[model samples]
Target: MTMPEQITPTGDMTVQTENLCAIFGGCAKCPGHAKAIDCGLVHLNPDALVFCIHGCHQLRVREKA
Candidate 1:
């Protein structure tokens, strides 16, 4: 028997493949700063929140700490 081919992450979440966008808040080094930046690869979680894969240090969609 042959096993099914595994799907690679491709640096993106399967759930939020469509309409993906990063929602950044605050500076990467500082939390006090609030800002938003557009990300190339963004994935949404169960709650439908966007997250950045690059780890820009900005506020991600969900708990990406």
Candidate 2:
């Protein structure tokens, strides 16, 4: 699946792709993250969080340490 352009809450436009999960990072915290990646609906943005457009709609965000 192709990535979709979406407007983020901060008003910045972000792009996502099927390979995003691998590019940014895998969503190990949530099961849905992996499912979305497998389904090719979730994409990742370096500046934003990873989320699924279909299936689980899981949001993946890196927690600051």
The 10 consecutive residues of candidate 1 with the worst lDDT sum are: 15-24
The number of the candidate with the highest TM-score is 2
* Pairs with steric clashes in candidate 2: none
Summing lDDT over every window of 10 consecutive residues in candidate 2, give the lowest-scoring window. Answer: 28-37
RMSD of each: 13.7, 10.6
Model 1 residue runs over 4 Å out of place are 1-47, 57-65
Give one digit per residue, the lDDT tens place, for model 1 in 1-65.
12112222345443222221222333353332221222223223323323334334345577668
Q: Which lDDT values do the candidates have, in the order given?
A: 0.30, 0.39
